[model samples]
Target: MKRTIDFILAAAGLLVLALPVCIIYVLVRWKLGSPAFFRQTRPGLHGKPFELVKFRSMTDEVHKLDSERITPFGQFLRSTSLDEIPQLWNVLKGDMSLIGPRPLLMSYLPLYTPEQMRRHNVRPGISGWAQVNGRCAVSWEEKFRLDIWYVDNQSFWLDVKIFFLTIKKVLIRQNVVGVDVNGIPFTGTSAESSSGK
Candidate 1:
């Protein structure tokens, strides 16, 4: 039932948002040149690695230096949460789900403590309990705690709430800070004892 819902929502979302994304793609091509999609390896369920997809929200060059070097339009896409739209493909491919802990880079997998690694018990998501709650504004510890909590309490209804919360978060344009490159190094297994477990 969950996979069914994931497929249906992911497919329907991709279909409906295709036209806007086309416009964004053309703009990105004109501005940043080819490869409007950015693909990166991330840990999926049970810490399995997969190519996570997103609309390119950074110049290929910017990626080489830092994501903060992102173009103005790229920043807009990220702040608006549109960069995440392409992950529906990952969903359709069964590499991700519509709702789960957001995937993190493969580099972070080794850093996970036994409890932190619990986040991988389910597929990664485009949006999760942490996203609507605080996103990048929250501390790394808070974020992981939320992720672990989702692992224990996830349900169809919880996913639905997260979906609706995501829409509201996007509309209000709140807590949509960029990925914290220099802010907080992901603490992983060393995360100051996640009390939320």
Candidate 2:
């Protein structure tokens, strides 16, 4: 039932935004040059590996870490939530949902303790409870708690709430971080920094 709604909404969104997506692609290719798509291996349901597609919202360079890799245009895409538009494909492929725990890097798999690993119990999402709450401004632990909480209590209405909250947050540009040319800045970096890089 949730998948049905996700399919309908994601397909509709992709169709409606096709032209804008193409314009972004052309701009990215013209500015960043080639490989207009950024592909990464992210864990899906049950920790399965899948290629997550996103617009190339960063500079094209080898060994450029994320913190130092974001571009001005990429920052715009991210802040406006336009960069994520490509993930509708992931939704269509069933690699993710319209709402669920947001997928993270495959390398972070080992970083999770047994409890934290519970986040992968369901399909990943384009937006979720954590996103509508505080986004990057929230603590890592809080984010995990929200993710786990969503796992414990997700439903059609909850997903609907999250979807609407996401739209409001995006339109108001609330609680999201600006990208630095070199990286995606961590909002609670001092806390994270005390632990380590």
The Cα local distance difference test for each model comes to 0.80, 0.80
Q: Model 1, range 93-120, lDDT digits (tens) per residue?
A: 9999988888877777777777778889
lDDT per residue as tens, model 2, 41-145:
989998999999988777866698764777888877878888788999999889999899888878777767666789999999988888787766666666777
Q: Roughly what TM-score does model 2 have, to 2 decimal places?
A: 0.86
Question: lDDT value for candidate 2?
Answer: 0.80
Inter-residue clash pairs, candidate 2:
67-182, 67-183, 67-184, 68-182, 68-183, 69-182
RMSD of each candidate?
2.6, 4.7
